[model samples]
Target: MSEQEHWDRETDLLVIGGGAAGMATALVAALEGLRPLLVEKTDQVGGTMSTSAGTVWIPGNRQSRDAGYGDTEAAAAAYMDALIGALDHTGIRAAYLRTGPQAIDYLRQRSEVRFVPSGKHPDYRDMPGAAVSGRALAPEMFDGRRLGRDFERIRPPIPEFLVLGGMMAGKDDIPRLINRFQSVGNFVYAGRLFLRYLTDRLRYSRGTRVVMGNALAARLFYSLRQQNVPVLFETTVQSLVRRGGAVAGAVLRTGDGQTLRVRATRGVVIATGGYGHNAGLRARFMPRPTPELSVACTSNTGDGIELGLAEGGTVAPDTQGPGAFWTPVSVTRRADGSRGVFPHLSLDRAKPGLIAVNSAGRRFVNEAHSYHDFVEGMYASHREVPTMPAHLICEAGFVRRYGLGHVYPGTTDLGPAERAGYLVTAPTLARLAERIQVPVEALQATVARYNDMARQGRDLDFGKGDTELNRFNGDPTQQPNPCLRPIEQGPFVALAVWPAEIATSTGLQTNADGQVLATDGTPIAGLYAAGNDMASIMMGTYPGPGTTLGPALTFGYRVAMHAAGRPVDAATGNGGQP
Candidate 1:
């Protein structure tokens, strides 16, 4: 082949991965007047955002500031320190904290990105000194018409499990919506599908409009395309090209096996997501049976981390990385082999008729904690069992309210659920326990004690009354105690549950500028990482909501800012003045 043929393309910034971080970096770079090239393993853009509700849990963000909520960079950092405690990486936190507002500003100014605060959602308080609100932000709902033809290619994040329009609402707002449940406004609010269908039909023939997660992906993708940022789909980066102790370029292989030597003038940003689908990496990091509850994209194979490591990058030794933190949730599969994994609490939340119990025939948790706590508790709950599978005990009433799994009211799967052995129903707790293979006497004793506590209006053992969210999901009409509603009626059901993780965190460590770090803690020149490819700066715990996607995007912007040699904001100390 001619030398000209070997050199396919060259650009100022080469972005590996098409996820939230990768696109953010590339878009920012393009806006800064640099030629940005993005390569995605999948055929489309969006990454996990395409499959997520797309909320950005940003503490002290511009949205919060606009809402008259006071927040400073120092306050954000303080919150971080309190949350992560000893595991906190100051440099990484500094980078995210400083660049957050700038990133939001950059996107809003240069792209179709527009966000609104899901007002009143607080930081997870159990993390030391967490706050109540003035933190979380989400993309203002958008019409799918923005994507036009691209709409069919991406997956919308699942909002069906939660209440209507509640995908990005703050924790405080949840109560107001719930309180007004039986009202006319509440009926309209709850009828999201009906509203969506009517609006789309009137506006456009394509009744599929992007909102929340899909909106985020569409907005970024729109910005990326407008800026003429080159996105090469079905192309994967094989390895890094090193020269003068710095990354010079990358060796890329297209789906057709055409090798392209693309040179990078400034740097290469690796945002190729986590290693959730790679079973081999899962065994190494998780070292356990992570049965399929992880909702992460199948394309997340840790390729970016692998390529970076080959070039002398130091991988963080945190078990909190991908495959480790995500619980392998048990899900009901469709005939086409697709499965629906609701973070578990959604079933317990709005449905009001199910309770989660462990192998010991006893309720383990409040069953309505936030997704972070629910997954964490599941991991802990597994330690007490032999196979580590909890039976999701539900009733006929629960199924009738929320619609079982993918087996909606009238589906064929519902028929199976009705069959003899699939769902078990008995008159007494002892009979139900006996059928499900639990100790009958132990089950009866546990229920009686729980009933007594319910009569007294307190959960002394588990402290269930700590969160208002828990109380909301519990029966409100019930007298003294809402959460203590006994499973007295017949017709019971149990679905085996497991720990399914969404993404892995184990990846290359990076500096404040999102530059990949070497073994000696030196920043690798011309190399950067974001998203699951980089070691999560947040340590093992999720701070609030949107913990993963929020930093991924902020760091992506930082990488672009650094690459373009832009002046950093003096007030926040994020990007240094060129």
Candidate 2:
């Protein structure tokens, strides 16, 4: 243990983790005239955010209003009430609703972080409180070149999510690239993107024009750099230092194996990503038959939660949903020997000719449902049979047009994937079922039923393409039901997928001000939490896109304002400026 006498450095605010929440905290604190120090366990800063779509689910934000979508705090509250009863988590939800828009306003006005409404992206569920559109917002494309050499410090997107070796394609870019050969406009678009990517490779290690979460992370990083905030990568908090019943500082361990005590006059904020990768914590907090796959950052091992717990912070109780955000992910080993966990968010599952089946070869879920609901369906199916690893079955035409998992569309070669056992391929549905170890007759029956439904453009059993969300991810060019297509082609393919977590919902309990609270429902003075370190305001139910990030940014803003002694707006729950 290092001696307290050897104090190395000090700051007014110490922010742990380098994701959206942590960076937001540090950035907001700095804007409030506080000297803040940010430390990251990994060499990079983005954490799991780099791998995401970078959508923030803040209802009634300026983006939505400006885009002519009429939404209100009351309306959003109504939706929340419908989704997860009105009485549950009323305070947290109210805090989020009030502060979220203000947080967006602050970031857009003061920092490089800019967001726009995600056009027509609907809420995850079609319940009473759901909005048809205009709730989710996504970060605009950011030029990573603005960060100069620091751009390298931004964690790149997941390898499987990229296209053409290292180039990142945004949501719009996907259709352009997939249809490049079909239309002149798409060809030009694809050509421009590839040419830019090729030119970028000549100088930078990766493309400089980034989108999605990479854009969001890079924008925040650029903001931090502009603010002169000291971000120390490869450094992590070992433990919190308590003095007179309050958190005073932290003992940090550097990448070089040196320990240093750093004191914070204002407070220390724990934004450490989450416990998604911590086996012990997962076994304890997560549901039984815990998922082996995690789409979160590798460094997210519940370090912040553990540190908070050491200081007497308590975890939020499990309620209606799983303690973590769930997704179905397919795993593949890259040529470099690294395992790639490809989260099935919106790429293929809902794209016309695909169906996810259990070991009994029965379709158990609405394939076009949101990723969270899809995994929930997986768990529900698991209760009935061995569905821990469900198989995503698709036909050759589907694979050729829409792709499966990391295997991109129009890929000329299936030999490598087949040899690597990532994909099970067969000429017939029965043979494919045999290859994947599912019952042949059951698979045949399931496909027959699915085919009959597809022809009529109706999914009677599961309602696959009924919702706006389902249609959004479906093939728009398809007739009748965009998500309904028969799998009559030969060479059927099956990829095994398992339930995976993106972020933990149950975490250190915090108040509306982001103050870390003890089990007795009292604040632990000078201790704060944001991001996954703070218990989710949604109470484990994912309402829409950006649910994790919206509250994270809002609470992060609240925490900084409270710590800096800035004037918080009573009506809006934000600080200083409106």
Candidate 3:
């Protein structure tokens, strides 16, 4: 087996983790005349990406230009300069800005991975050069039947993201589903979706008309299957084997408890996500009084980062702002009593007639800003007040119109949410404040002030609907300000929100070639990292909608190209042998 190049013991590249970055590495490596093998400790693939929105922020792509988006390299640079505001890591940024388009083009042409321009997505920040839509690309939906029986191997979306028991409801489908009775087109679409789901439920555990992250994962899985690449599931890389002071292979523990030493001649890519789920790392790097919730998969317990560190790599030091990308999450008890961690990413936070309040029922930040900014407000307000478990206050009318977190729109009976302890409801604001344990007088005062500001068409406390991002997420039908509406309706409700990570930006330090760097700033010859395992190119600042995924997929391509004996050519935005 060791003598044969194609057997289990030998391969050109050994990729650890079945997430996007690792899959991208192996797929690209296979395309470049290399024999690659991927080993994932988790039984199923995709990791945290399976539950994500699956938008990739790529500038100067062909798809966006074709969609009439006016995005340019110069404009993107200005946007980055405004958000990052430093000359640090200029080379890496330049490389990413150069290699991104090439990476997307490569995968689209050679593999099953395909992305299209999001019709109306906007940057998280409305700064200079922030085009409304061109920069963020969404993965095209893929059919799970393409994978045959392997469809079961792809991880499902977050349970709360599904509707009608096991049917996935993407953001694009929600509006149509909600308005199905109002429009014939929507009714037809909704009917078709339900029919497909009903048929799929008979054969599959969940509906297979997958979208978002599930689609992306299914596409990657299909591509690897087509290429005949071997991905050993439920396999753990116990220790890295080094030869001539460079990583050459790893000792692995198979799912059935068999030990195997696999040898790699090319390189090793660590893409097991970040330390988002690691308790010790959360204490070391996250905010004090450490957050107990994470949106990342539980398998992402700092495996890749720790592996890189043991191989002489250092944690990236150029990070700024929050180490982890933050979002407000709500907890619910599933049917079987398991905890359901639902991340509030762009569903209902920025809508009209809703306001986020601290423990004292006082408004703190702009409700229409980015989720990252929303969590930053939580941390800031927590300094002087107890804001850890803030409540998103809204009326029953707000719930019927916009829904509150996991509670679907038009939910008349609040008994289910109340019984599950997921929502608080009362007949009046005073009762609601008492129920949620906030000051009743402060709650009344805050509501009155907010209503006044809404009627006056301005936010006196914090500019709510001021930014382009804010207005984009708001209800456009509202006259004065799309994000402003008085909470005058009764049967008030409140959903508890807590700070949690959507992704970790601080990770293993690496060079422009995507090779992990030693503590002294030298690249490790045969060790590479990507996805969240690699240090964020944005210096921990989330500049736009798909910031994390954009760099993640791009660096995955960069590292794989490097291992294929070709680094990116800065001038041409493609690879060249050095």
**Winning candidate number (lDDT):** 2
Q: Rank the candidates by TM-score, best first.
A: 3, 2, 1
TM-score against native, each model: 0.86, 0.96, 0.97
**Model 3: per-residue Cα lDDT at residue 479:** 65
Query: How close to the true structure is residue 92 of candidate 1, measured as C-alpha lDDT?
Result: 66
- Ten residues in a row with the worst lDDT in model 2? 566-575
- Tens-place lDDT digits, model 3, residues 382-469: 9999999999998898888888888888788888899889999999999999999999999999999999999988997998888888
- List per-prediction Cα lDDT, in the order shown: 0.68, 0.89, 0.86
Scored against the true structure, residue 64 in model 2 reaches a CA lDDT of: 89
- Mark the regions of model 2 whose C-alpha exceeds 4 Å error after superposition: 1-6, 88-90, 567-574
Summarize candidate 1's per-residue lDDT along 1-578 as a digit string, tens digits. Answer: 86445556788989999988998989888888899999998787887777676778676688788888776777767777886664444466776776787788767866888788776566654554465666777876666666677655455455433333323333333444554456877656646644665665665443455566667888888888788787788999888887688897899999888999998989899998877777766667663455555677778887887888888898756545333445425555433555556544343532344556677777776655665566666666666754356666655555554444433332223446545233455556666787778777866676666556756766676655456545545556755655555554656656666677656667778877788988898889999998888888776666676787788888888888889987354354645322
Candidate 2, residues 84-147, lDDT tens digits: the string is 7788443777878887898999999999989988878889888776887889999999988788
